[model samples]
Target: MLLFVIDLLGRTGPFSETLPAGIQAVVAGSAQKAADFHVNPPPAAQCASCHAEHFQDWSRSSHARSLTSEGFLRTFPQYLDFVGIRAREDPQVSMACFNCHAPLLKNADSEIIRRVAAFVVAKDINKLDGFEVGCVACHAEGNGVFSGPIRNPKGNLFHASKFSASYKEASFCATCHTWAPASIPCSDVYSDWKKSRAAKQGTTCQACHMAERVGITAVGLPQRKIRSHIVPGGRSADLLQKAVALHLKAAFRQEHLEVTATVRNLTPHRVPDG
Candidate 1:
């Protein structure tokens, strides 16, 4: 039955009403638990005041728009419908979508998940307006602790700051970028990179997505190699165009034309990766 469901999902996307009873029950149970969980972090505005440059860059990134983007808004409902779940009736089902898009809520207790799911189902966008993938989502470690890659960050008057080596590693991005939920490979970019030459050379997701820049992480801090928050990905047409090189060769023989093209992927991961 599990194999059957997986096969069916592969062919039909995530929107199938004929999923096995047991699978549906499992999904439903997970949804119930997710609906009950709820956690809220500090707003982006709080971070903006101190890390102006980082905040500004993030404001224009896809991470900031993850939840509210038109693509996500449209696809989320289709996913729910495919899985035979309703946002209002079984808000827990939406947890899978929120796990990455809204990590803050992903940590929430079951009750809070339910409450927030209700708001989502009712289309009450304002209720969770400021709680999308904001600055605090990745930087803040629950409560008030904030973390980053800087070893010895100096001048920070607002909140508690800490240095974490993990921030500089590619595994940090695996949390979301390589996550496979419900037997579906959602974003396998990290997995692809792990097996790539880049990983062997100690290259990390930050190396590409968050390119380095000489700037202050926060107010009153010295200039340093701070990772930019621009976070470009596959959607970046300019980046994509430059990520590969195409070489073409043509020959004519006996009134016949033959062409050979060699494509090289400049990036570590697979071309057209998520």
Candidate 2:
């Protein structure tokens, strides 16, 4: 649960027929059920067909690489064995692990689960790379539609679109990030955020990670407020540098020089955190 478990874990369309600013497109189709997303979910490439830019930014994010990330892949088998050996029962390995890495695993066909588990058992981790936990994980929810802060005005004949306020709230992230809330354990990122100055001042996880930008999210969309999907964290050198500052001074004594150093934290929350 230390390095491997905790490290895991956004994105448009159309060109002509732009609608008025802040107006969502009129839907000609009913929404799909959540079941549609939970089983054999469409890959990010499907969404990339329309929302190219958002998909591009998302591709660079850790979310895109969660399953195949070298660090996690190297340790995942150990984790599975640890759990299995301890429980000594039918270990629903894919269900427990993929809940965060690949939500589509839940209620998936038995064959899909078997193949994924087989890959894990054989140490053929690379096979899992093509299996993407894409748009369905966050945007598709109980509402039976893909959602965002702003819906694409030039709607597609494809899936139904809707606007959801949950996309604008940090708690939406807690869906996966909350490993232990009451105990405020290392994995409880939401808890850490609650104690942060950013939380007190209303700065959200999206403010620093997703970075606000004004641009067309999809091909036909007009320039409106949008967030980048880059989502940098401690692994980003520039972001880490910005989180803290250091100062030093020296003074000459009668026979020697004395030096003093100070470190100042500039971030809303703790640095070098789990």
lDDT of 2 by residue, 165-230 (tens): 778788877767767534222266777788887789888778778888877676676777778887
- CA RMSD for every model? 15.8, 9.8
Model 2 misplaced regions, further than 4 Å: 1-39, 85-91, 109-111, 123-133, 142-144, 180-186, 250-259
Q: Which whole-number lDDT from 0 to 100 does residue 117 have in model 1?
A: 61
TM-score of each: 0.75, 0.73
Which candidate has the top score in TM-score? Answer: 1
Model number with the top lDDT:
1
Q: What C-alpha lDDT do the candidate models reach, one value each?
A: 0.67, 0.61
- lDDT tens digits, residues 1-274, model 1? 2222111111212424464344454334333333322213444644565677898998888888777777776677677768884454564677887888777776566666676665655566666654577777777764346788777766433346788888888888888887756545366788888888989998888887888888977766677777788798888887788788989999998899999999999787777755
Clashes of each: 17, 2
Alpha-carbon runs more than 4 Å astray in model 1: 1-39, 85-91, 122-124, 180-185, 249-259
